[model samples]
Target chain A: MTLTHLNARGEAHMVDVADKQETRREARARGSVHMQAATLALLSEGGLPKGDVLATARIAGIQAAKRTHELIPLCHALALSKVTIEFTLDEAESCVHVEAFCRLNGRTGVEMEALTAVSVACLTLYDMCKAVDKGMTIDGVRLEEKRGGRSGDWSREPMPEPAAATSRDPSAEAEKPAEAEKSAAISPTSGVKIQFLAELRERFETAECVLEWARLPSRDIAGVKLALINQDPKYKALLNQRVLCARNEAMSQNEAAVAPGDEIAFFPPVTGG
Target chain B: MKIVINVQQDAFNTEVEQARLTEGRSDIGAIVSFTGWVRDFNERPDVSALTLEHFPGMTEKALHVIAREAGERWALQGATIIHRVGRLEPGDAIVLVMTASAHRRAAFEACDFIMDYLKTRAPFWKKEHTDSGSYWVSERQSDREAASRWEHS
Candidate 1:
């Protein structure tokens, strides 16, 4: 694709949008700042040294969005009808999610403005929290979506998991450290464990029971249920009710295969919101 | 896809949950959310309180499965499912489901799909306290049918 903001000589220049139609356009951008859990708690409780980190960040984001054109060399200045900067505090990850929205009826897209807002917001957060958490990291800054303009609407697709760091070099694996820290979700050689949950536990009176792999009649959930019933007739209650089964934390049908050291759970249908 | 699943006893802020899905990303063109609240009348009008019980580890796993399936079905950028357990009074929020995508339809449908599957597949039992007594809430046939429709579509 040809560059829109460049002349044939390749010198950067803003494209003339005078003839472009005035249409409603909207854009959103997001980013995050990771910090210590204690830092986040202090910020949330208004105990941060900066007095109010989120409020300051929000104001900074809005101001940055309005002045995006001034900061960027070739961006066209358009009056944004609305600019909203929002934040979400994540306790488990000790991070703050920042989002910005820019909307207007104009010729140019506001994606850059929204992105600028989020970037400034994250930077402001870092500035306010740096006193307490010097190692905070600001990342994941990107445009979430845009609507209107001649190119039409666009949105980001789901991101794929990051590629393994050492996988790029095939020889690195041979020299890598021992694999003792491998995934603990699935362990080999241990016998299958059956777990009863909620109402099922109340009826069965046992939270969990293990079965030897070699003694099982089969390796499927149906077979496991039969074996469990043989051990205790009360287990037959599960068969009578609309019991649901899960193999290794995923919903599984009765015929789903199971291996040694796998976790199996049975419960009734959910009535949650 | 970014998926966040939380099963806790504390209340969740809808706006914060929405921000969790949309923040720091501009590629989402549309977002749809559904919040379920504890109504004063469910099976009876004089209900005073409700208690939600769920399988601890399995609850989060089941919600993850549901949210992941929604992400697979739709071109979703992010999804969140927060379900509250423990005793809840009337007007308390019980669950929140949010889906972000490029188009309104995908976001709307994914949110609906998550709620439908969550109601039937998630291992949560609700017991409502009425004027007469408290009883374990029964699964609705409509919820099952709602979830089944997605399979054919």
Candidate 2:
């Protein structure tokens, strides 16, 4: 059976550029990951037991490029000439900046393949370190530049500032190698680079904050994951918090109970899922 | 004629393209160049490092695209792209694209055109590890907006 505009269930389509060129082609793409200071420290020291975060992510990025078809369903597998992944320490924000570049000599452009590499790399880091920090975010995955075929020449727009990804003093971080050395004993790895994230501390709030079981003696709040129905930019950071380890309070389902005059109704679980 | 992509190699720094483009003849008036470096920040002060990833078959394809684009947009004699991959420190040369044109305007504008589009549309993801946690640079609306400028112009 031949099917167009459908891959399996909903609908799918494959873009064909078979009539194009065999000219030399290359693309430069960049994306970024925002992480906590501790997480950055662990990565720099190469302390995470799961593996070298950057190395593994590097490998994953390549694999993701190869498997973009599987993940995205219709991407064409092209013979890639080269793949390069790099990591740079951003000391000011305690984060790592990842840039991926892919190349191929084929009919179709490799933008999706390049993007897939960046996406997979970020996800791998998140999966490996979600235990410690929850504010991790993936950003700026875009086509930095591309060349090849009938499209002739195409480039990305200029950022407001060339150093759009700004941060504090990271090069000086090497000065305090002692910090990394202290953590080195934590594992066979050498001392980790003690990076620092300089984001301001944020506050989390919710309209329908409630405990799952208000009546339980132990406060049966273990299995529930926190959710916010609607959030403005001011509190969007709250969504980034994976699991709050703080001694936070949760009211019963439906609505939280207020003491004293009991003027407000506690936020309850959404009426619908 | 010869180009290289380096990662902390002890071999050379010969920003040789300058001499190479000029070659034996000194008549070539302009050599436009762009050198992108790893900065210390990523919007948040806690960012400590950056990790760049690429697709093996496609990485070269994309660079070629940028090179070809530079050629098409300007009156170019020759151009080369040298982008390093792997772990890099702050101040390291992340990418170098150079164009040699008969006149300064063609070389300079072509070089700027290449970099402008590269910054916004290139499909590479950069993940920053900060003190607070690790996060991906959100896809920039500004980047899209920037790229859009070329479409109308």
Per-prediction TM-score: 0.52, 0.36
Which ranges of candidate 2 are over 4 A from the true structure? A1-12, A159-273, B1-153
Candidate 1 lDDT tens digits, B64-104: 76886786577788899999999999989999998899899
How close to the true structure is residue A115 of candidate 1, measured as C-alpha lDDT? 93
Question: Per-residue lDDT of B42-88 in model 2, one digit per residue for the tens?
Answer: 66876676655433333354455555555645567666555555445
Off by over 4 Å in 1: A1-191, A212-215
Sequence-dependent TM-score of model 2 = 0.36
Looking at candidate 2 chain B, the ten consecutive residues that score lowest on lDDT are B1-10
**Quality of model 1 by C-alpha lDDT:** 0.81
lDDT of 1 by residue, A38-98 (tens): 8876676566677777889999999999999899999988799999898877777889999
DockQ for each numbered candidate: 0.28, 0.01
Residue A264's lDDT in candidate 2: 19
Deviation in angstroms for A79 in model 1? 70
Q: Report lDDT (Cα) of residue B147, candidate 2.
A: 57
User: What is the Cα-based lDDT of residue B41 in candidate 2?
Assistant: 79
Model 2 residue A194 CA deviation in Å: 32
Q: How much is the lDDT of residue A271 in candidate 1?
A: 85
* Cα error of candidate 1 at position B142, Å: 0.2
